[model samples]
Target: MPEVLVQYQAEIWQAIGETFIMVGVSILAAILIGLPAGTVLFLCRKGQAFENQVVFSVMNLFINVIRSFPFLLLVVFLIPFTRVLIGTAIGTAAATVPLSIIAIAHYSRLVEQALLDVPKGVMEAAISMGASLKELIFKFLYVEARSGLVLGLTTSIISFISYSTIMGVVGGGGIGDFAIRYGYQQFKTDLMVYMIVIMIILVQFIQFSGTTVSRWIDKR
Candidate 1:
């Protein structure tokens, strides 16, 4: 091992664990809340099964507003709310508040787009077969859009990892935070490069896995 890695192996491992916690929570929020929210958005569109212009407009506007904020600013802006919810806006837990909010917004838009890509004929066919709303979605819509959904989730996870990097501003230490504090601040350029390389490898692995799984499951 390089001198830098040997010197900071423990810290590096701790940082990785912190990053996983933040990203894991964000992923959970994305799937549990964002997925349903996107489904609702799709259902409420102008001509969908549960079409309601008012609901669609309000939800669309809300998502747009959330996504419009620059991520750094969004983190600072949510400090008070984070404190209220997590009892402090200065740690990994507090950082998750903003990460999760952004994850939901980010993943939801992609999910909506993925669902939109499903052919209208699929819906019509499901309805013609007397499929209920739930059955139509499970048996037709989601099935057809599975690959896109997986791809969107993979994309969202990458973004979440990127977002987690900036959490160091709030003392939410992760690998990025470690690099900034120990490597950049200390002028250890090689260390910083190593951290960046790790991140690149992590992202590449995730993308490849997601793509492979998507292709394997995709029927059309």
Candidate 2:
């Protein structure tokens, strides 16, 4: 067993690296897009910042549609669109396209929920103080609710890690592909077990770090 591990150690590490790449890039993109999307969703809703019933309904429907699709079908469904954007539909890069979209849709709702947790009075106070819209959002909403936002982002990232595993079905190189090829197909239960252990540890670390940071930042 030790010898087998030693022999495939490089492959194992490479797969881990690939998994990190997929998760990291996807999460970053999700944050960039989802944050604004969620902010807009929040602001456009009834009785909110820029409340527009028509715009809110449209954005809400779009988000719901994207979030409703299962990840597997989402990957398959995006094959054509993915091909158009990246010129191929099977690889880490191609895989990232769908993963990012999934992350954005997933995280946007989380962000919206987090922002909603902010007190209505906070907005009232900020506006009364003559705060600009930018100041109200960035300084008041985001700053005051930062801990919740962090927790939301942390949850989304952990979910992204799990979702990335499914990318193996499309020839995306990650721990999932590694496990499917060398562990399941080759009947190497040991490798499979190792992968599971690694994933567990990764999840634990993410949870721990997120919680710790949230606690540290939280004044209330």
lDDT of 2 by residue, 1-220 (tens): 5766787999998999889999998889878999988888888899996788898899889889988999999999999999999999988888999999988888888888988999999999999999998999899999888998899989988998899899987778888788888999999998888888889999999999999999999987
List model 1 lDDT by residue over 33-131, tens digit each. 999889889989998878999989998998999999999999999999999999999999999999999999999899899999999888888989999
For model 2 the local lDDT of residue 150 reads: 92
In candidate 2, how many Å is residue 151 off? 0.6
The residue pairs found clashing in candidate 1 are none
Per-model lDDT: 0.95, 0.89
Name the lDDT value of residue 91 in candidate 1.
92
Q: After superposition, how far is residue 153 of candidate 1 from its true place, in Å?
A: 0.4
lDDT of model 1 at residue 9? 98
